[model samples]
Target: MPKANSALSRRAFLTSSAAGLAAFSSIIAFRANAQAAAGELLMVPAAPNPHGAIERLFLLHGDPLAGPIRKIVTESGNPVPAPTMESGARRVLRLMHFNDMHNHITDMHDKRGDTHRMSQIVRRMQETRAAAAENEVVLLLGGGDDHTGSVFDELLGWEPEEFVADAGYRVNSAAGVDVAVLGNHEFDRGAEMLRLGIEKDARFPLLSANVHSSAHIARDRDYTSAAVAEVKGMRIGFIGLTTQVDTRIGQPDDPDMGVASPVEAVRNVLPALSQVCDVVVILSHCGYGTGQSRSGKAGADRMIGEGDFDIAAAAGPLTDKPVVLIGGHSHTRLNAEGLNPDNVIDGVLMTQAEANGKYLGEITMSLAADQGRTGWFTHVGLHPIKSRDDRVAADDPKFDTFEKEDDYDAAFEEAHVAPLRLALQSKLAEAIGTVTAGDAVSTATVEAERYVGENALLNFMNDALVKRSAGFANGTVDLALFNATAILSGVAQGPLSFGDWYDVMPYADQVHIATMTGAQIHDMLQSNAKRIVRPEEADALDFSGFISRGFLHFSDGLRYRLVLGDAVADARAEDITLHGQPLDSMSERQFRVAFNSYVRLGGFSEAWNGKAIGAGVPGQIQGMDLRGLEYEESGLVYRNEIIAQIRQDGGISADAATLDGRLTVA
Candidate 1:
């Protein structure tokens, strides 16, 4: 991996006079002079005096490329515009924001091959900033989820002492990320691991206003709730806010550390940030929607209707400081119009680049001062990080496929990222065991099939959990259950590599067992009926919403027939049996159930909403509370358990292990 010293050296060289005149333009660089004081603003001094009197003006045209060119108005010393505020006034602040990278270091899925390579993306931004005008300041920001997606992230996370942090942060730091907001996934491995592993080595500020820690870990952790940067004489305050979902999805690093509500967090932090800065930007990982209606050409109004807490709705009323919100988590692509059909919001602008480093969102904000008040407006565009297709028309005889070559920096990749990429490929390409499926499968196939009913991949995962629980839960675990969406992708019917399996189950969730009564089990299954679509209600079904919530997938030993009724609330799960015997319905009858932490803790709101198994239910099951259950940690992550099962069974046979009639939907 590239070192931080090399990054600093590169930046110093770019700003040096020997690099050329263009290098001197807009030298707003992040300099690590010394360890920044907690909450201290990293201020870059403004450029030296210009040749003559310059008037700075901000133009809010719809075009991103259209900005106020240099305009010099010379009069015989009629008090030239004050150098402090008006000298570089014409320059616009250009921000490159990306979120939910999920450790996608390579452009593997880009068939067109024009997407941004992680290394190339950073180099391109640096080059752009190097050539920018003195007044033009470029800031790169990450919205979060910098850990736990790819095999490299997993491997590097396992070896934090040598790697310093996850590969994503190491690469991003080398790529020159100014600041990042903490996402829910950053806490996937627990807060302490993140603090000691990733946060300890981060080159930039990782802020989260809502995430609080009272333990000793907080003493060494330099993370602050907010940060300010002085870009071209203007102080821009950044208030970071993470989703409150960490309480449901993952364990906090410290026993005392906890996340506060995003709404309240924002409201509390805005006043302090606004007092110190001309403009305030909210760096959030809370997401624009509630994991539903992620994609569509829907306008802001309709999109807002689909979401639980959108950018405009969350931070709009908090303050009037020309706020710009960069969001993540739902991976929704938002534009400048702000989610409203009319694409207009008062005193605010919202934007988010899609996940996986596929696109880089650039927002050029034109700032103007009117009667002692500063006004900020923006022109936003999400640009694809394309690959270089150098094939010429003469080279490709079949169909004239000549196209404009994309801007791909080869030297940057070789120097900063290629070594790490090669290492990851070498380590993760090793074959673990042969994994087969009854039919061809991919992320799309498994996702599409699992929506309506049971599928082979989900069944395979449930079986692994069942087998894993027996060893740890005192051999009392009766059945294993999981959400269909937990199986992210499917393996091909061949020798499965570790990378392939990691892709299928990338999260860090662990297996857990809880005891629930037969009545509670029935209520849990009935609650799943909310996601089912009856024949008559097909027209009203929101497919995206249902899929986002996902359905329950249980082991073969636990069988039940789901009988759909005219209304979803009336649906019945009949003939429920455990190991071929009718389940006892006595109030005292109990069955030990095995499941991942996500389900055991009621993280799947759609399945546990009205059920008596988890929290917020009227008649909660005794000893079935999310955290109160005498839960035993299986000590193995979900993927490792699956790998262990596959290895112990010699090789998984696809045809023999087909989905049984365990969960029949009619």
Candidate 2:
């Protein structure tokens, strides 16, 4: 893991020589200074390319003459050839696909950084486009999830009123993306923000065949179901398909939007697209799940909607032209080392790069009308942006390397992303409150204790919700409850900043107060036991157990004993109490409970092998009436509520996490 910019001070950074160049390119200056000050990874270029624009630009490559490009073979046992103009082929195309970028604009710090750098991706794509031959054309396609999963999502607020800038999408536009599919996370901010990105930031068209929005944004004008790109007199048609699972989650902004079946959506559009196009490409955000998982295990099915495998099988017979599917959602690394044969579903050529811009998926193929519009997949593989450690480990000199941030991308970063970076950095670094709680809870501790049982940080989060929501509640709120998975990252001890807490809970979930009787409360708690696994058993659990997101943590004043059985069906919640009183004693008494929006709108249910094993919160809780003031308002988001509580309390108390057998798992 990389160190946070703990030693780099903003004041010193502002005074440095690099900072003096702020008027020119603040991002480049900041990157240089930050690297020097914090000892971050310094990218080393192998050697400058002598061929210039004639050769492909790669951050990692083998012997330039013998084998500069990594090779993948077909079932016939022949090495995939490098890009070259084949006289036999009628049309030559280089399709570059990447998915699940999740807004990691700058270089990442963790192992993900070792592979993905947006700057590196941009440079490679630019070079690919520039080097295209007169007869050959290159197209870069995004496979969805172009938003969320970073501090960028936080700094760039979601709603129209809170928007800071379309920093993420603006960078993509500069990258020259031809078309992108709609990902589930795109709806994380709201439909309006999605519309705003397409309207203001996107230079390319966004396609989604299944997603229909009743929002004010025009249908074909703002976003379309399909788009065609005419390259070198070749008509290449693209149809986008989004997973229907998330659209049903009922986001506040996307209330009017609906998601239909991906297979059905693709079927309807193929007929119209095939009429005028030479080839059809399915820009899919549904998933790449079929036959085997990434781990090489059998039946590696995606937990979500119908996967690309199913889509390809259903849509293959509908189109006479060569069909290609570029996918996202599952974040499957289709060609990690090279092209995996499993990706070829039916006759449709398929590819998906792993999430977070770690690797760029490249498929070099040609369409020839010699034998009825056949598509030849010449080459398929990934271009990895290697880290310093990766370069050192390989220790090979024959491969020429490229800097992670070239001048072209650096300029773009400076113009588009630097200001937001600076603003977010300063704001995150400011100490909003102190972590005066029990010996300053470390992030490591939170990670260790989050799944096993009750912990201080968990108590602190739920307590914050309870305390804040109690203020707005007309009567006393009994307690707060949230899923364990809600906490993405842990907070550091001592002086706390918004960044610290932001890392812990980044999702823009609203706080809600639900009216429920004691019986209903017990049912929710009982369902929780089915998902709870001991820390020791966590790693060994099957896919169904891992996918289950129902394990819960209660706020202070509530206690429950989770008893494990031989199987999940036998598991149950017992000895439940609120304010030291057994909950069963007051079964008829109504209780006001505070929780996040995910709980109120229950969709955490999961299935494996077509059967529900995890017990999610029942959609219809008995005697339930969700009535409250300002509970569902946009301003009452969980993060804001916690921030308000922290500010009011000055700091968390040392006893906030004091576990007095509040929650016991056996």
Q: What does candidate 2's lDDT look like per residue over 1-666, in tens digits? A: 111123434444224323323321212111212121111111111111221111111111111112111222222223322222222335557888788887866643333222235667767877886776544667778899888766777655745777766666777776667677878877766677777777777766777767775474444556566665544445566788888754434555456777777787666556545654567788988876642223211112224547788899887887577788888877777776766777776778778887777778888766663333353545688887544233433356633453333323666566666776776777666667877664435666665666567777778878877777656735556788776656765655677777667777766577666677788778777766765555445565433212344457888678888887766666788989888899999888887777676555554323211234322212222221222212434346787788888888876777765566788888
Would you list the C-alpha lDDT of every candidate in the order shown? 0.58, 0.61
List CA RMSD, all candidates.
10.4, 15.7
Task: lDDT for model 1, please.
Answer: 0.58
What's each prediction's TM-score?
A: 0.77, 0.76
For candidate 2, the per-residue lDDT at 89 reads 33
Candidate 1 residues 225-306, lDDT tens each? 6665555455566767777653343342245666666666565556545554456777888766543333432111111121
Candidate 1: list runs displaced more than 4 Å. Answer: 1-88, 107-116, 156-164, 214-220, 246-255, 289-320, 336-344, 370-374, 387-406, 440-444, 469-476, 533-546, 585-587, 604-628
Worst 10 residues of 1 by lDDT: 57-66
TM-score of 2: 0.76
Instruction: Count steric clashes of candidate 1.
Output: 12
Candidate 1 lDDT score at position 424: 70
Candidate 2 lDDT score at position 23: 23
For residue 71, model 1's alpha carbon misses the true position, in angstroms, by: 37
